[model samples]
Target: MNRRKSREIAMKLLFEISINTNDVSETIENYKENNENFDDVDFAYVENILDGVAKNNEFLNKTIEGNLTNWKLSRISKVNMSILKIAVYEICFQEDIPSKVSANEAVNLAKKYSDDKSPSFINGVIGNIIKLK
Candidate 1:
C-alpha cells in the first residue's frame, strides 16, 4: 500500500484502540483478520502509534490541552483526537518524517474521516505543537 493508505489504516487502528481500551495484542489480532493488505511495515507503524500514544498519553494530552485555544481535549471527537495524536507524535518524535509531511497527511486524514472543522482544528493543534517544540 502507499504511504497515505498506510497512514489511513494506522489512524483507523489507533481509533479502534482508543474506543475499545482492550489489550493491544488482541485488538491487533482482530484488526489483522480484516486487513488483508497490511504488511510488516504497516504493522510496525500501527503498533508504534498505538503503543507510543498509550505510553505518552498523559504528556501528549497535557500538551494538547495546553495548546488548544478554546476546545478541551475531551471535547474533541475520539477519532479526530486519535488522528491528531498519531500525527503529532510523528512530528515530535519521528525526525525522519518531515513535519510538513506529517501535518499534510493529518489534514488529509481529517478531511477524509472527520467533519469540515477537523482539518483546520487538527492543523492548528499540530501547528502549535510544532511551534512549541
Candidate 2:
C-alpha cells in the first residue's frame, strides 16, 4: 500500500496497543498474519511507526502535551492520541518525511477516526509543534 494506507494501519495498531498494552512487535505480527492483504501494506513503515512511537512514548507525549493549548494529555481520546503519537514520531524521528506532510496526514487521520472537532485540534497542535521545531 501507499504511505497513507500504511499510516492508517499503523495508527489503528497503535490505538489497539494503547488500549490493550500489548507487545508492539507481537501485535504487528499477529495483525499481518490475520490480514490477507499484506502485499500493499508497507510493513517497514508500519513497523517504524510502531517501534518509533513505543520507543519514544514519553518524549512524544511530552512534546504533544507541551504543544497543547488548554488541553491535558489525559483528556485526549485514544484515537487522537494514537494519531498524534504517530505524527509526532514521524515529524521528530523520520528525516525523510516532511513535517507538513506528517501534520497533514495526522489531520486526515483525525478527521477519519476522531470526532468532528478533532481535525482542527490536531492541526493546531501539530502546527505549534512544527513551528517550535
Q: lDDT, candidate 1, residue 96?
A: 86
**Candidate 1 at residue 4, lDDT?**
74
On the 0 to 100 scale, the lDDT of residue 125 in model 1 is 91
> Candidate 2, residue 74: CA error in Å?
0.3
Candidate 1 structure quality by residue, lDDT tens digits, 15-129: 8878887866777789777757565346666677778878888887887888899888889998898888888888877888899899999999999999998999999999998
Per-model TM against the reference = 0.91, 0.96
Off by over 4 Å in 1: 39-41
Whole-model lDDT per candidate? 0.83, 0.93
